[model samples]
Target: MEFRYDKEADANYVRLRHEQYAYREEINTERRIDYAADRKPIGVELLCASEGVDLRNLPEQDAISDLLSQHHIKVLAS
Candidate 1:
């Protein structure tokens, strides 16, 4: 998994797989879910960065941290 942030777009993306995305859906405001061709979830996109995701209440923050703990992932924030 990977986390990418775009300062210009103020967007954040959590990539769960390196596979190409087949479809995307806006689950709600400023949030989109990406799926692979086989319907497997590939990742999630958070638009407007801070407005889209609250670090204090991130639903998957713990899960992501746990995954990152298994690997050497460099975190960046602005």
Candidate 2:
């Protein structure tokens, strides 16, 4: 899996595989789930990053850490 933060867009995307999205489901105001043509979840997108997902913001303090531990996330350090 790959998570990328686009500084210019202030958004983050998590891609599990390079599959064409059949449709996107807005899980919430800021999160979207991307599904492949086969109806499999292939990716996720977060609209606003700097506010919603502070490295310190997850309800569980270690949530982000756990996630990063499982996959590769590219966040350019400022």
RMSD, every candidate, angstroms: 6.0, 6.7
Tens digit per residue, CA lDDT, model 2, 1-78: 666778898787767678888998876676677889998777767666666543322222254445644544432221
**Top TM-score model:** 1
TM-score of each: 0.66, 0.63
| Backbone clash numbers for all candidates listed | 0, 0
Q: What is the C-alpha lDDT of each candidate?
A: 0.65, 0.61
| Candidate 1, residue 77: lDDT | 26
**Model 1 TM-score (2 dp):** 0.66
Considering only N, C-alpha and C atoms within 3 Å, which residue pairs clash in candidate 1? none
